[model samples]
Structures are given as C-alpha cells and as structure tokens.
Target: MDRWAWANGLLDMAETLVIQQRGVRLYDGDDKTKFDSGTLLLTTHRLLWRNQKTSDCCISLPLWQIVFFEEQAAGIGKSAKIIIHLQVAAPNKESGPYQSSKYSFIKLSFREHGQIEFYRRLAEELSQKRWERISVPQPVPAGRSQPGRVKAVGIVGIERKLAEKRKETDKNISEAFEDLSKLMNKAKEMVDLSKSIANKIKEKQGDISEDETIRFKSYLLSMGIADPVTRETHGSGTHYHMQLAKQLVTMLHAPLEEQGGMMALTEVYCLTNRARGMELLSPEDLVNACKMFEALKLPMRLRVFDSGVMVVQLQSHNEDEMIASALETVSERGFLSSEEYAKLVGISVLLAKERLLLAEKFGHLCRDDSVESLRFYPNLFLTQD
Candidate 1:
C-alpha cells in the first residue's frame, strides 16, 4: 500500500471519491430480490460497497468495467436509484443469433437527495478520463504518413526536435552544477598546483618517479567531494553524528572482512575522512559516534588494548580463534616469521607481531629470536619435539 493512500483511508493514491453516501442499497445483475444494505462510495477509480456490520466486507467495481450510468427515479417515499451497466462477461455462444451484446447491471439507491449530483460528477470524471486518453501522442513510423496522424520526418527533417532535446539536456546539466561550479573551479586550481609541485620536485630531486607524480595528481583530483553531508544539511549535531556512524559502519565492512574482522582506528579515520571530503569529522566526533553503536545494537565495537592502540572489531571476534589460527599457521610450515604470519592472518605485519606476542604470552606459541631471523613455533610442537 502507498503510505499516503493508507493514511488517507484509500486503496491507492490515484483513487478519488465522487460520492460517499450512507444507507444505500446495492442490487446485483437481475437480482432485485437479493440486495445489500451498506454504505456506497463512488470514486474516480472504482465503486466500493462496504457492509454496515463488517469492516472488511466490501466489493469493488472498477470504473473501467463500468459501461453506463443512468438515473432511475424510484416511487415516492423511497430512495433515488442509478443503474450501472457493466461489461463483465463475454457474449454467450449458445444464445440466439441476434443476442451478440452481453452485459451486467448494478443498481444503487441513496436515501439522500444527491443522486443527480452523483450522476453528473461520475459523467464528468469519465469524460475527463476519455479526453486524457485521446490527447496522448502516438508514435509514428519513419517516412510514413497517415491522413489524420503526425508522422516522423526522419533525422534530416527533424532539426527542431534535435535542438529542443539538446536544450533540455543542457538545462538539466546547468541545474545540477549551479551549486557546485565554484567547487569544481577550485578543484581545477588544485590540479594545476599539483602539476607545478610535481615539476618543481623533478627539477630539484631528480628521483621522483612518474608513477609518484601520477599518484599525486590523482589524489588531488579526489579531494573535492561531489556530495557531502554536514550538520547544515542533516540538521542537529546529534543527527549528523548518527548519520556519520551509519556511513562508517557501511564502509568498514569490506576492509574489516579483509583484515580478519578488525581494523586500526587510524586507518578507518583516514579512509572515512578522505571519503567525506571537506566535511571531515574530528577524532572525538568519530569516537562519540562509535559509542552510540553499542546502544544501537550494531554488530561492531571500539576496542582499546593495554598499549592504547584503538581498533574497530566485530563483537564476534575471539582471541582464542586468532591464537588457534596462529598455531595452525606456525605448525603447518614448522615455523612462521612475522611477514609469514601477516600473510596467514590477513593483517599488517605490526598487527601480526602483536598477535604473535599475545599468543606467546598465553603459551599457545613460542618465539625464537635469533640473529638471522625471528620466528614463531607452536608451543605443543616445541614441547613434543
């Protein structure tokens, strides 16, 4: 259901009621003896009959199915009635030779004196629908002409159409860029500044590679944010922080998965702030926003080790699992260096060393720091051997 239509007590937003009358009688095709007493609603889209006792007991007759509406005066002391001709069934095949036309009828009687008004409104709305259908333009084949229809004149003869289309496209582009033209100009200036710096560095150092210069230019190009959400646009400091937290969580999913369900706070800050562009958040703001995640029951949390290195880690992350993985990796090759552990655990060398030291502390692994190269071995393997 459409929210607006639900709020308005309607089936769809396109439906509009022309008549809502209580104490109405509805009779189906050729069934004068059997009638329903209910409230009748006639809309531009459909006719609805709602039973007086049951809320969900209602029948619908779409306007498209209705073929005719004519007034019929009931006798005195009774209500006014209108007969609706409906195209519900196909022509009967077993009928007589002249019985090609087939239809059904519904009779509605209203106790109030607005039957004439209802008939006029229904007629007007149906006429408007017909007019709208007739006014729509139909496609014409190329190089073909009809007596009463417009024809497509092909590319050579449609200069006016091409100009109009081009004008419309340009207008849309202009509207979209009207607010960001200044920022775009500043971005161009930044690119020029980057080129000048690159040239100066090459002249002085003679060691700056072309790849580095290209990377610098690309970074300069990525600095300007096409769309940034700030307090000014999102309203209130609290709302801005909440929105930023949601964006951070969404962006961290891939990197966290790649980094074994955790990432250094420093890396997340740099990446998220760079993506945010001019509306970068402070470290404190990021921290506060992350604090709200616990209350919001998000899947991740902020973790600070004894050495004061903060990280974003999934709540499901387990140190025991990390240690088990480290033990398996070291036992597989008989030993693992810091670089090998980093590759095995899918984390940076620094983080990998931290986990190795922690595992050594817990007696899960033993480190051999020799002059040649430092390596780790599973404690069980070392003990068994």
Candidate 2:
C-alpha cells in the first residue's frame, strides 16, 4: 500500500514484537501486490512484511496510519483476510513498492489460517496504543545529565529533586483519576508510568514503600493486564464470557501456580480487578466467566465446596492427589486438626478442612470430635488391620 514505508526489518528502539505469521499476502486495496508470500510481523509500532525468499526486501506500515480494520471470512477458494482501512498517505512517507495509490486501504490475506488470533492481538495492540507509550524516555546513563540540564550537587539538592519528582508523580496520579471518563482514557498510560516509577524506586531503595499494602499494590500494578477482555470489545452474552474465561486462565496461570495450585474466588476477584487497573469486573461477571472455564476447556476450573466456598483451581490439582497428601500428613502427625494442617501446608483453613474431609470420605482417615478441637486420624481399621 502507498501508506507503507521501506524498512530494513530491524525494530526501532522501544518497539517490541506482538505476533508474527507466515504465508501472508499483501493487497493494495482489492488488487494483489507483488508480495504474494511472506512473513507478516505485528510490532508495537508497525506492521512489517518480509519477503519469504529474499529476506532483505521488507516493507512496514506504521500502526498510526491505520484508521480501522475488519475481518473478511474465508470462503470458497479464498483465504481469510484482514482489511485495514488507512488514513491518507502522509507526504513524508518513505519510498515503498508504490509511489501512489488509488485506494485508501490494504488487505492482508492469511493463507495458513492464523487470522483469528492475529486479529485478536491486533485489536488489543490498537486498543492499548503501545506505540504512544514508546516515546517515554529510558533511564539516563550513570553520572550523566542531559545537555542544558542542571545537575543536583549536594544532599539538599538531591532531596529537593526527589521531592519534585514525587510531587509530579502525585499530580499525574490525581489527574488520571479526577474523572471516570478521563481515567478510562488514561488508564494504560497511568499504569505504565506508575509501574516505571515503582521499578525505579525498587532499584534504588530495594522497595517501593514500607507499607505492606502499598508494596502489595505495587506488585499487583506490575502484573497489570495490557488489555482486558470486556463486552465493549468482544460483545455481550456467551461470547463475552467465553473470551473472558480464556483471558482469565492466561492471566491467572502464574498466580495460581504460586498459590498452591488453587485460590478462593474472592481472592481471585480482588487480584483480577487490581491487575485490570480501572476496568473493575463485577462479582457476578467474574462468576459467570469462571463458570465457562470448564466449558471452554481451559487449564483451570471453578469448584464449589459443600460448605458453599468457591475456588478456581488448576485442572492438574487432582482430588486423588490432594486426598493422598492429606492422608500422609495426618498419618505423620497421628492426628491433625484443619488449622494445624493449614499452617503446615500454607493453605487456607477452609481448604485444609475440605482436604481432610475428602480423605475421611475415602476411608483413608477417621475424624474425632472433642471438647478441644476436631481432628483427623489415619483410619486404623483399614491401615493397621
């Protein structure tokens, strides 16, 4: 397309790869271009197409030039395509395959069937507009100040500079959340800026703050999702919940692994909302989305205990494994209460009780009710006899 520019296939500073696919063809509007087969790369700033055979030949179009895009489904004898509508070619656009064009759009034909995922990622990138964030300056080199910039000399000067920086950060935070509509528009920028500040503080002082809540919040902000699935993007009803379930599975995978392979739904809701930044999810919506985890065949599923507590746990967190582990623990201690087991295993008392109860149900353990505490003991009838 005329909007494209000749590129050397190297990414610009701060630009990062989003996704890539092979067997893609470029079209100048509805007409096919010479680039019939190649690898298409989606980066934070550009859409680059590299020749499949001649690696040196490459072209890129800045994402800023894109007005919008839509998918054209695969049909009889045709591959699926993404039609990218573009703004008018800028006068300073670099030399490309075409010096001029009759149309204001281009098409990318995906022969190998990756259009669905490509479209999804592309939509997310556009929504987040990471290219805008790329302009943020990297840390200055040690012992160097920008030309014409004053360098702080003594402790007093350094303290003053720190105070000014803190004031600026506070101001930015205040402006970002002054209005609901404004907060939504600036959420990604604010999150990224806050994370950068937190990282700098950690690198210099070894922690963001002394307060435990602030430290935990900074950790949550560090895990902020770039683009969360919402009805606005995926549509409402079953489709939205299905997409939401998939996104939750991807986002919670690491957190779940760290939390002994399971987390209470309430904890999940808090973490998910915090990681989502301004896009807070409702409890009802979260429950609805989690209900589809099994239907969608995700790595995790929602479970409701007999006592009405709900949890999201990895599929690999098998009941048999839990029961066996609990039985072993009870056997080692001779008898154990849920509270004691919870402390030993570093899990919630409720979950510990559930595990012990499950082992009892399987005849691997026996329960005793006493004035002091209820405890579980290995079933002597089955084990000793």
Candidate 3:
C-alpha cells in the first residue's frame, strides 16, 4: 500500500489522496519553531502533515491559502526543506489597521535520496489544488459578499469593437434581432475569444519564470471532468458503461486537440484515472467502456494496431492526411525514423512505430530493417536509387 493509504487509515473522514511521501518532518518557517516528525500527504483539497507519534497535532493547509513555495538544500544526515508560503484570509468582522496581511509559512523536510522528485510532486499537487479551488464554485457564507469571478481583460475591447460596428449599422432597429440559436452561437464566439485571450496570457506569463510553468501545468490539470459518471452514480451495468463511454468521449476533446487528434490508450488511461479521483476505474474497466464507443456511435473510435498498441482517435481522423504528411516530411531525406515521426505526429515513438506500420500495411510506405536501425520511406521511393 502507498503512504497515502497509510495516512488515509489515520483520517476519520474520507478523502482523496493526491500524493504522499514518508519520513517527513515539519517546522515553523517564521520562528523556526521546534520540529515535529511526520509523514506528508497531499489530498485533493488540502496538504496534510501528520505526526507519527501524536495524531492530534497534525497540520493541514488548504489550497486557497497557498501563495508560493521555496526550497533549501540539505547537508549530511539532514533532509532538504520546503518552505510553503500561505496567505490565510483574516476574519471579515475583525478588520483593523493593526491586523497583518495574515501571511504564514511552514517548512517540511524529506530524505535526500529522492528530494527532487518529492519537491516536484509536491509543487505539482499544490498547483493543481490551487487551480481546482479556483475553478470550482463554492457556496458563499450568509451576509458575506461573493468573491469576484475571473474575466478576460480582452473582453472589454471585444465588446467595444462590437458596439462600434453596431453603431455603424442600423441603431434604431432593436427588438431581440437575433434568434435564440444565433444568440447562443454569438455567445459561444465570445466565450472562445475569451478563452483564447486567457491562454495567451498564461503562455506569456509561463515564459517569465519556472514558477509560472508549474502554475500553468496545474491550471491545465484542473480542467478535469466536473461530473464524472461512476459505478455509484450510474450503477454497474451496460447502461453505466455506455454513459461512461459517452462522458469519456466528451472529455477527450481537449486532450485530442493537444495530441494532434490521436492519443495512445495508455495515456488515455492515466488521464481518465487522474480525472476520476478516488473513484478510479480499472484498466479493464476503462477498455471495456471505450469498446462501447463504436456501438454508441460516438465521434471517437478505439483502434488496435498489429503490434497490439491501442489508441483512441476521432472517426474523422484521416489516415490519408497522416500518410501525406509523413511522406512530405521524408520527401527530401527519403527516410524517417520513429523518433522523427513522433515529433512530427505529436505522439510517443512506440505509437509512431505503429503508425508507420499502419501506413506500410496500407502500401503507402516501405520499411528497411537493419541490425543498426530501422527506417521508413514512401513506397514509391522503393523503385528509385
């Protein structure tokens, strides 16, 4: 069992584990208060550091409270320390000039053996938790003002341009001019434009610092399935698998776009499981669910290569387009390797090999196998020098 399972055993309430590392010690980052030994756990919603000796003294940090993290290298017999910066919100009724910004910090130490991995995983979980907290809506307390929602700063310019164009046309004619469908389409366009601006901002900010890159990754991961169908909700039956398959297909749109419209089944499994959280489905279950896609007439299909490597691709994904592109890539060189094809195709080398084999099966390409390496070329090139 994982350290997270051990930690969950200690908890009285149910929680979803994100990441966990053992043999951790905590200290107050501000005063360097007396150290406490424990195991560190990151859950879907909070950071937990539990004292191995005393259960009552465990410390919890919510995602909304985190601001940043800093690390310090360690010497012999000492583990590396991670200083987590947090901005705890002050009570609304207790406002005064004397009240500080509510900044706090905590330090955690772990063995030097895999300190880098520990740090990376912690940062990843922290970033993802923060984004999830931001993206998901939360209930407001009674009599408290709701927090302001995020809006694309570029939307103002877009609205201004639309208004100017509207003024140039007939201004007197105004009676819900657009039908419901047209209005919905216009709203979708505005939403797409806003998303584009947000992505551009994220890209620019990510280039500024390594911290921003981590933050960007977290934001991307937080775009998970908001309403994942599970055995509990949909029951264990064909109907459940059918619903799960449909949801999976819908959720795959963004990932498919990122991977150039095709993705390895292994990658799909990992992403789906991560999105499922504590209600993770087994690999067999996922495969079975995917198998129903064809029967359900979803836009995606599961294809198994001769090598037994499986992939999920859009029904509209054209093999001829892929073959044409691959041929173009190797036209001048007259040869291509899986590595080169992978970079061109935005897939793993193993999956690229399968693609090459598929093209060869279609008689679009020919392969040259040697003791040193294997290469592929357009089938027509076989007759040339």
Candidate 4:
C-alpha cells in the first residue's frame, strides 16, 4: 500500500491518503531539523517537511518508532491545535469519490497550556485500542533438538511436485488461470525483493560464500513475474492507470513512420508493448489505445489485417516519393534485387510495391516482367539530366 504523503505547497506529489491531510503529519516525518513556522509531516515510513522560500526539501522518517507524545503538546494554544487520534485507514491514489471515517478527540484541552482538568480517554471512548505497540514476539525455545533440525537437507522442492501444476487438462486450465492470477499480484514484489537481496549480497561479496551467493541470486532472478493486480497506486486501481499506455502510444510514432503509409494492427501492439517491457496490452486494449491516438489527428492509422497481421502506422502518406526513391535506388544498382531494395529502407515487398505504384504514377519507375522474374527500373524518359 502506498503511504499518504503531503506538504502544504505542492498538491501534485500528494497520493495515498484515506483523507486529504488526515493521516498526513503536519510535522516533518523525515527530518531532524527544528522549524519555527514551516509545516512538517511525520509518518511511520517517511517524515516530510517543506522549506518554502528556497529550494524545498521534505524531511522523512523511515521507521514507526516516532510517534505522538503528551509532553509535546505543552504551551500550544487550543484554537491553533486540533489533536485527534484516528484509526488509520488505507492509502489510496486518485482524485475524487473520497471516503470519510469517524474519529473522536481522545484528549481535548480548551487551550494549549490550560490545566482545566479536562479528560483524555482512548480504548473506552472508541471501543478500540488507542495506542498500538510494535514489538517482536518473543521466541520460544525448542524442546529437544529434533532430527529435522539437525538433519541434512535435501532438495526442498522437487520438479515432480509442480508436474501437476503444469499438466492441468484443458478443462482445468481456466481454474489454473485463477491460481496464476493470484500469483500475479505477489509476483512483482518477489522481483523487487530479489533486487534488494542481490544488492545486499554484492555489498558483502567476500564476507559471504561466493557459490551460495551466486546460486541465491540466480534463483531469485528466475522468480521474476509481472504483477498486474496492483492498483494504479492505491490498493485497487488509480489515476496513473493509463500513463504507461499513453507513453507507449507516443513512443510508437518513429517505427510507424518507417512502415510505408500503413502497418498491421497486431504489429503495432507487439512493437508498442515490447517497448513497455512487461506491461503487455490485450488486443482490445491496443485497439482502444489506437483510437485515442487517432483522436489527436496524428498522421497514423489503426489498420486491419486481412492476413491477420494488423498494424498501426503513420501515413507515410507520401507513397509516391517513397516508391520513386526505391525504384531509383534499384535502377542505380544496375540489377539490384528486390530484397536488397527492401532492406535499405526497412519495409516489406508488399509495402514497397505500394510505394512503387505511387512512383509509377509519378513516372519514376517502369515495371517489366519475365517468366523468371519481375523488376522495376528508373524511367530514363523522365530523366532530370
């Protein structure tokens, strides 16, 4: 879950708060610096405080030990203070349709320094524990060193153990897919954890067994899996949801331009999604993406594949010149094959022929065919010289 972090100045960085500034600390959660007037945010994960007049840096606290103390409330005015302890909620990252949960002031003081003998109630007031302590559970000593504890270990997981997992019948495939889906959510975390562990191993290379470290790193690396269940930011789905796809749409332009005036729709999906690494798109997702792309009036088309190789491409729409150039490149080669012509400009024969026809209309190339071969050459009649 993402932690809600905010500062008084920039709303752009704010994300993951059950309520705006609700769980966000007004004191820096990350810094040791003392401040008289500037706002600081403190949290279990990161202390954040902002410097206003100059280059702003937010101080962050990374551990949960920092917390509220009764002594810290001394000399602060009542009107300026709103001291309330809430049952903290989940962190979310999105714009609207927010949530509201009930909270009560555990201790209320009329003024900061006033000793009016006011009340402070926690567990009984909310019917919930006000203070939570996080401590490691005490370990229980083993009764007798068991055979299992002293025994030499064999392979923990045998290949045969997962044979059933891999050998599911076609009917069970759907059910298997559900299990795969569950694994998908945790998959990304495993990948990230591996990187951390690998870095640790590298940091203490000589101190650790080299063979053991290498084997561990390889095993961890092999466990990488893409987790799509993660919400865009908050726990379910979010505002940055379409961000990577949007970026892919933008990145598709250069390759599209070189693909003659049109490309197969499927090709665009492969190329665009590959550029995104693990964030592959479904065909329908790719299509919808292209529709959004077309709305921008980009010189590209979402084309169908009569042959099942659909693509998205920019309208090199200057087909005539492209064909003319291809024919001219061939004519100068004195018998250059079609394969050679296609390679230099990065296109297929089908697209090249389309360009050639356009050039033919412009009188740049003349097609001649024999039983053995067919080819095009520059039109000497239209010679510039």
The clash numbers for all candidates, in the given order, read 0, 0, 0, 26
Candidate 2: deviation at residue 129, Å? Answer: 26
Using lDDT as the measure, the top candidate is: 2
What does candidate 1's lDDT look like per residue over 52-127, in tens digits? 6766566565566667788888687866788888764444222211232232676777654456556777787676
- The global Cα lDDT (0 to 1) of model 3 is 0.68
Give all TM-scores, in the order shown: 0.38, 0.44, 0.45, 0.32
User: Candidate 4, residues 1-385: lDDT per residue as tens digits?
Assistant: 1222333333222111111111122322222113323333322123344543443544322223222423233353322232434334344422211133233112222221121111122112122221122111222458845343333234533343244335434435877799999899799889999899789968987887778868976764454333321121221112222443355455666556556556656566566555545645567656665665455555565655343445566655664556656776877775444555667777775555555555666677777777766677778787766
lDDT for model 4, please.
0.44
Residue-wise lDDT of candidate 3 within 1-385, one digit each (tens)? 0011122234322235656665676655444333345667776566777766776555555555667888887777765777777665445522321234323666677641334556677677675453452242344678976557543248795676466547534432453465666899999999999999899887786466788778977987876677788653443457668998999998887788777678999999999988877768788878989899899999998998778889999888888887666777766678888988888767899888877887788777888898857899888855567
Worst 10 residues of 4 by lDDT: 14-23
TM-score of 4: 0.32
Q: How many backbone clashes does candidate 3 have?
A: 0
Better of 1 and 4 by lDDT: 1
Clashing pairs in 2: none
Per-model lDDT: 0.67, 0.85, 0.68, 0.44
Two-way TM-score contest, 1 vs 2, winner: 2
